[model samples]
Target: MKIVLASASLRRQELLKRIIQDFHIVVSNFSEDSIMYNNDPKDYVIKLSQGKAREVSERIDHEALIIGADTVVVLENKIMGKPKDEGDAFNMLKNLSGKWHKVYSGITLINTKDGKSISDYVCTKVKFSHISDEDIQKYINTGEPMDKAGAYGIQGLGGIFVEAINGCYYNVVGFPLNKISGMLKQMV
Candidate 1:
């Protein structure tokens, strides 16, 4: 079976590589603005994932199983997305310092041949160390957090700020391999 990943994320592609070998990657052009303005983070990600999957599925019917995923960080009911600027990154790091936050990754799998769809979410709790303003600036200067959600990428140099994590490591990295594997196995 042909599989397609509808995301431009290199992290997602790397994670998925551990499970599937024969697949294609297509970056989805769906606007992310809608997700930021939505009230429910869960629904926001699910919708984003579904939208990406549908976009890819439309081009490859009866031959593709499209997978799409969206992840975001939330603390105290406030959803935090990627930092818009360096100052924003610093502010985000300051806010996340010495606090616990929830990282949610919503995944969508769509089988075009059978018209079957699955949507689910995985959440991880991450606690941060007492990151100083200087450290935040140095981290931001590294330019690793610019494209990552919550202004930090656990799989990169930003890992130093994470004191502990209470869920799937891959989930924090942007994809939940076990969940996606289980869900896809039944379908494939």
Candidate 2:
């Protein structure tokens, strides 16, 4: 059996490498906008994850296990995806400063051979330290938050802004190793 990851995120790929290195990175060009945010955060992420996995699975053989994942930061029940631009990122960081938010990652794996599929969600509570306007501006200027949800990447320079987190740290980084390992054990 071969393992394939369906995402372009280096962070996720790196996380997966820490557990299982026998994998290939095949980014799924699935447009993330198709998933509606009106549904529960977990459900929405799962839908996106499934869609991504299916997108990649279509071109692979039955023995390939394609893994796809989607993450979102939920604040007050509102889902926040990757920021649109610098201004949007600034606002997102501002909103997250000194506040607690939930990070939800939906992971899905599909084995096209048997049409086997599994979808699960991992949640982490993260709290950010109060950030000054200047600090936020500096962080935004660096352009590190542009491609990250909630305008921050806990594994990057943005980690400086996070004061604490409750739950799997790897989930916020991009992949939940424990969750992924548990699922893989069952499938294998």
Q: Best by lDDT, which number?
A: 2
Candidate 2 lDDT over 49-100, as tens digits, reads: 9999999998765579899998899998998888999889989999999999
| Alpha-carbon local distance difference test for all models | 0.88, 0.90
**What TM-score against the true fold does each predicted structure earn?**
0.95, 0.96
Q: Tens digit of lDDT per residue, candidate 1, span 1-188?
A: 78999988988998999999878997887777755546677787788888888888887646788898999898786888899999888888999999999998889999888889999888899999999889999999999989888999999999999999999989999999998999898778
Model 1 pairs in collision: none
List ranges where model 1 is wrong by over 4 Å.
36-38
What TM-score number comes out for model 1?
Answer: 0.95
